[model samples]
Target: MLPINFYGKPTIGGVIGFLFLFTAFMRKKTYTKKTKGLFIKQRPEKKCFKCQGFGIIRCDLCSGKGFVFYERKYQRSDPCPKCFQKRYDMCPFCQGNGERSFLGKTGSNKYNKKIFRIFE
Candidate 1:
């Protein structure tokens, strides 16, 4: 007994009743537990006062842990065939762990004359 058209539209049942009321008002709201602060606090590990924490030292000429088998005697010819002496090889100039920055030689020529008077 369905014969409605125009004003009383039945155009395919009004597009399936507006797609079932737009899929029941498109739902998706439901979530809780709002209190974010992750919890992160960790920073404390800096101890290297000239290899005090044993980072590396003692090698002041094979003292740390290298090699140093000594015995010398150059009487005349070919006796000095690199016997074995080695001294402060790595620590020549903070190359080891002296921490550098001795700033000698008049403090780097007074810091290059104050950077050439601040670039002239």
Candidate 2:
């Protein structure tokens, strides 16, 4: 009988186990008909109001100059590390993606829907 060494070179049994694991890992998962439709529909994306779809904004640190002087001296200036000399930072509101979900209801009833449903 071949000695089973799980850590070392695979024996026949080990090879079989490996094949079993590999096949299991490679197998495609199937979703039931009911489950396939259970996922929430994605909301439409819109340009971020804060960044105006630019994905970046004026860096507060360098004031959009892309660099700053060590002590307001023209002789010595340091590249703005915050924006990598790009003069802009990732939009805090959009996280640099430049878009966000269009909030509130959509479709025909969107205009008719009351802000406070409890009052209706």
Candidate 3:
């Protein structure tokens, strides 16, 4: 018999136990003949308000210079204080994806009619 390692990995015993659990759980699931699957409707994409869809905005630390100097006498260029090395980093609000979307309620399908009824 294989030993069960709970946190890290699946042992033979763990797999068997999980299969038994999943089967037991699935047995309790009831499906109605009129039930329909949930639908994921596409939402219109909008530009990220933070970056204005640019995926980046000016780095406030270096004043958009993309670099800074350690000492005026040394006269050397270093990575921007804010952007690290790049002139710009991904917009914090949009996470650099440059788009936004959201889920909305459209009426429920046959399956979720009961679920949606609760919201109303």
Candidate 4:
């Protein structure tokens, strides 16, 4: 039998305190109440300067035809060499989404607005 103050065995009050602390630490830290989906944590997506938020653009190589014609003295039509017959490829800059995210604000005050994950 040990004394009441035995450090090896935790008291009821100590256990409660520990549980409270653990729960507090497990919570997510945010500036406001979170209603975001459990799987997706969406962020601010700005319009891609190149695609202009259209999610697509005319194929520069094939002129949006998805294929090309060999124009050397009227050669036969063939798949576009650039897009590999797909006519449109994912934009390298915005990955075909035509939108991007701004993590930090720029010189303009309007950019200071934050986009939370709840809008979607």
Candidate 5:
């Protein structure tokens, strides 16, 4: 048995044990929130400049008429090979989605101002 007051000071072992218990009680754990469905990383997206969010554009070969008229054979019209008589083709710029994805805002501002290219 040991005296309650040994030299009027706490033992080193007592102090160390108290400190370990204090730190163990104060420690914290972190957890991530659970969400439904598979996780998908989001990225910045902007409207396509060429299609202007319409997803399609007039066919260049047919000029939106779906057929081309030739004067060599008494002015005969034929379906355009490029558009297959649809008169419009999927926009290559946006891949028919009318939207483009980018990693950041760098140079994205230029796309905000609708700028469609003209073809003759």
Candidate 6:
């Protein structure tokens, strides 16, 4: 049997500490790749003729300003009578931001091999 002193040597402690420190130091290294899918194609900006680029129209009643304070005898807490409530008219089709399209199917060959197995 070996002596307990042999198992508790400073060199053994140093080796374990060195290994722990080396692993910690190695984990700090990082690798990165510029993937093709990461480069997204930005859509070109298109001018919207409906809102004329202002993105909103004047309120028909308040003329788009949203407020008209008038004084008489009675006071009311209602919005402008001319504009009603909403100050902007969103695009009826695109709903304002202007881009519109249907996403098509993105085909994949990974499922091709499984089709024959399912039929069999």
Q: Pick the candidate with the highest lDDT.
A: 2
Evaluation by TM-score, superior candidate among 2 and 5: 5
- C-alpha lDDT score of every prediction, in listed order: 0.43, 0.67, 0.64, 0.61, 0.66, 0.50
Candidate 1: misplaced stretches above 4 Å?
1-44, 52-54, 63-65, 69-71, 74-120
Q: In the order shown, what is each candidate's alpha-carbon RMSD?
A: 24.2, 14.7, 17.5, 12.5, 16.7, 17.5
- Kindly list the per-residue Cα lDDT of model 5 for residues 59-105, writing each as its tens digit: 99889999998898588999999999999999766667666634212
Q: For all candidates, what are the clash counts?
A: 2, 0, 0, 1, 0, 5
Give every collision pair in model 1.
Answer: 58-64, 59-64
Please estimate how well model 3 matches the true structure, expressed as its whole-model Cα lDDT: 0.64
List of clashing residue pairs for candidate 3: none
State every prediction's TM-score relative to the real structure.
0.18, 0.41, 0.38, 0.40, 0.45, 0.28
Q: Which is the winner by lDDT between candidate 5 and candidate 6?
A: 5
Off by over 4 Å in 6: 1-44, 68-77, 81-86, 99-120
> Which portions of model 3 miss their true places by more than 4 Å?
1-45, 70-77, 101-120
- 3-113, model 4: which lDDT tens digit per residue? 234557777776777777888999765223446644433322577666666555677888989778676766788788888876776655565655664533233343344
Higher-ranked by lDDT: 1 or 4: 4
lDDT of 6 at 86: 69
Q: Residue 82 deviation, candidate 3, in Å? A: 3.7
State residue 7's C-alpha deviation in candidate 3, in Å: 59
Better of 3 and 6 by lDDT: 3
Task: Using TM-score, give the best candidate's number.
Answer: 5
Worst 10 residues of 2 by lDDT: 103-112
TM-score of 6: 0.28
> What is the C-alpha lDDT profile of model 1 across 26-45, one tens digit per residue?
75433232457553322114
